[model samples]
Target: MGDDHWLDLDTSKYPFPNTLWHIKPPKEIAIKVTVMLIVGIIGIILNSIILHILIKNRWLWSPSNYLIGNLALVDLITLLLCPWFMLVRDFYQQYVLKHFGCYFEGFLQASLLLTSVGAVMLVSYDRLAAAGLTPDARVTKSAAIKLIVITWIASMLLSLPWITHREYVERQWADYLETFCAEDPKVLGIYWHFTLFILVWIPLGLMVVTYGAIMWRLEWSAKKLSSKGAGMAVSKAKTSAMRIAACVLITAVICRIPYTVLIYWRNRLSNEVNSVEGSFDAMWFAANYLIYMNCAVNPLIYGFTNRRFRKAMDRTPGIAWCKFGSWCCVYPVYKRKRILEVDKNTEKVFVIEGTPRPNRKLAHVIKNILHINKETLDFSVKIDEVTTKPTKITPLKI
Candidate 1:
């Protein structure tokens, strides 16, 4: 097993005096690898949790949520494919992955980046439509699915250049053969500029426009309402929506702007300086860290800002186990039971739990059984006993 002559390659082509194959990773490279590994692990876990929550909960299956789920999926794929390869390339002097890995990594990164940007734009537009239009005019589930398919297709088409231009090359040093993957420098300059425009500027522009319009429309609707109560409700809703949108948009810009600037700087420098080293620099590390950090931060943003998502996460069995221990793993049997309560004055019917008690106040009965707020329940009400099975009760007119 130890007699492996295949490993003993000729070193005559190497430029260096020493012929040692092993090279110790530099401090900067080690730090970059560590940070990237940490971020990738965090991103993978967070994205998986987001996808799990979205998939497991039937109530969260809305058109908007579908797009959000797609974004999470994209980020998850990006973290899985891009970062590890980048870390490997940074740590190793010679590219271990050959031509296939080069093309695959390049294509995957380009396509996913575009898909993520497109998804974010679509989400912003979906929010705009929901805020400004009637329920009938908002995007439907079918429409959102079609949009997602189109985004992926478009991203693939846009990323075709990566497949065409990327190449695996080997150069000889004094005592080592250096291998690396790179794109056609001529094509990279033009292609990357176009990608930057699509990935950063366009999405940023759309987010601002869509979210701004939503806020304006909300404010206008609030102003048109005559009742102060209605106005306050609208104001409250606007504030909540704005808060979520602001956090998402702000984080996106902060994460992407540095990477965009780094690319721009590199492209400009490449034009002037005949050659640039493939080794990672401070700017490269920082830019990459921010971009990958975005993936981990997205789940945090949603979990923190969106009350519904937080509530859903709380109800998730896995999360429940974490919070409440192993006892939460026991599934409770739910029996179909409902009580019909009719308000005497307003004639409004409500579905309550448990058996009706004769001569007892409706609010008191509901408070004891369902633990519902008494203030929301009508004091003057009549209860009608219904069968303890899944059945609808029509409201009786008094």
Candidate 2:
């Protein structure tokens, strides 16, 4: 078309306030986008449910669960950000973000992604450690948070090169000079290597090592226990746990392998042929999204594989309420905790005795699950929990 005719054609509907950078999406690509949006929403909602279960059931806050919670939190952040970037690229087709905006968002996103993978690895390691059945020190709840913090710091440190070379630049396209945020092509190789190593390889290695060892350990233990005439229940539980670990690790590997392979392929082709984007196709776009599926599907795996988690989810109100309902509860202020133990029906049950809940009515509502008779409980203050003050136990209501 001639320039004059092209200019005369409706240009008003093409720019910002008039349009939200809405390019008419092709049918096939549009379908993929719609499906992604639906899945992303479901993942976020389900993860939110997991968060609610974790919060309400204070008893579930063990070190391993803490890691799981952290993973969920990071994946939630990833799901939120991934679509945003996709929209920016798909709709605007330009970097609307200025220099600092680009840098900050990029850094935060990379760190969150790295932290999510790190959290998954930590969860696997915690499980492996737990299976040791040794009295040696175990990872504490606080330690899990500490490890996540370290991962965040490491992610930022590793992503620094991307930030340092980042620029908002204008490039000539078919008919326009498009602006976008990106690393300098000169430093792209560096960024790619760092991203592949830290974001993919290292985490995958740890997950494989940790979960693999757990699988081996559990198999050995099962054999030994069977020989010792141990009940099948204990062996079964370990088997289930091993299966859970394997599922998580394998799913992560499968989801990420394509993305990683594509990245490597792109780099190799760049060396032999040219920039991969020059030949960008639907497969490339699909591969880009493939790794993100891991984040979206992880909660499904947890819900499916773990019986207790499934039970709690079942007990939770409707799925919608459970996922996004935590905001409704005005949680009490964080306070130091002291655990107390009571001998009950041959099982040693532990109870969370924290500073009184802000809502006085619910303060004595037993927070931890324990099977015991109400009569034997000592309502009168017993031994001082942290101090010498006698502790008071409230009656368990029917």
Candidate 3:
């Protein structure tokens, strides 16, 4: 809101006019809203598909799979919460500020924020135990389920203040702005500690320690490779290890590190220190948004870097229905419904129909006949404008 004094951080007046709820231009606001909407839609769809796939393949219910699934679900919540953000940012720009909107936006933001932290920490542990310390150390399905449940509970508890403090307040200044879903400074201070402790500090420490240990073990293993007469095997193993390490490192550096630094810096600085409405605050806000983008980035990274994930994605029926974007891919979940995708550039639409029941013997016979991997046989139908629905045809069988 344009009520500069409303923010708990500082009392300094923002040189920007208070007549309008937001200082930004309408065009800029529109652009930001559009981008957030696009990203949110894509994120939800992709993560949904991934979750469905994991469900379809029971293997996806494994401990690692459960963690990934929870991550996707958290991302889904974050995406669903974007519209509130889009609305407030737009409303603020238009000089229309409502108490309810503020609370909604702030509450959703906190919920998603906490959930994201929990999800990432869960993922870090999953990777550490599953891939780093002992590749053979598999988490039981029940344990994984318990972990996800606990993550959700923690997220809910941590976000309670935001929900509790949603209210309409008038600043001493002539400006009357609604403060939706945000706690008072004192309450928020408590929350800040919890969030920083769980989300920032703990995860950073675990990632550094676990990844470091893994790298050390990998280096030691590489040394043994030469003496074991498995030079080529060792080289390949090392390469795989390096790739995983690189992925973790990049994710940590580009996503988590900056946000953590910013939080610490903001806390340490006096209210007046960073209260000026200038390029710095704008940059800081942009940086905060960029950190949020990390949630959407996970699937893209998984699709590109993980060969098996890519191959599986390609085989998914109705993938063509997803819009193709420069930075992201969109796809439909072919679970209970059979759908055909029609995509051209950024525009994508889907037509749904009844999915065929899997005939085990028939599927095996067809796979053998077609000389293709049975796992790749994701049965689907095609739809065209005139069809109004899916038009099923016998798939090619060897």
Candidate that scores best on lDDT: 1
Question: Per-candidate RMSD vs. true structure?
Answer: 9.9, 12.6, 13.1
Candidate 1 regions exceeding 4 Å error are: 1-30, 226-229, 270-280, 323-398
Which tens-of-lDDT digit does each residue in 336-384 have in candidate 3? 1332333223342332234344467977667554633322233232221
lDDT of 1 at 221: 85
The candidate with the higher TM-score, 1 or 3, is 1
- Whole-model lDDT, model 2: 0.63
**Pairs in clash, predicted candidate 2:** 49-323, 381-391
- Tens-place lDDT per residue, model 2, 1-398, is 01224323454444421122335357755776787887689779767877877887776777777877777888887887766665455444456666766777767667777777777777767766887646465788788779978977886787676678776655443445446575565676667767777667877888778777766777787788888777475677666666667777787777777767767676656332114333454446666576667788887665444545655665565653443232221231111111222222344333435533444454335432221233225433333212353334444333
C-alpha-based local distance difference test score of model 1: 0.71
- Candidate 3 lDDT for residue 151: 75
lDDT of 1 by residue, 168-268 (tens): 86656655676667667678769888998997889888888888888899889888773544687688778877877788789978988988888867765
TM-score of each: 0.73, 0.68, 0.66
Error of 1 at 145 (Å): 1.3
Best by TM-score: 1
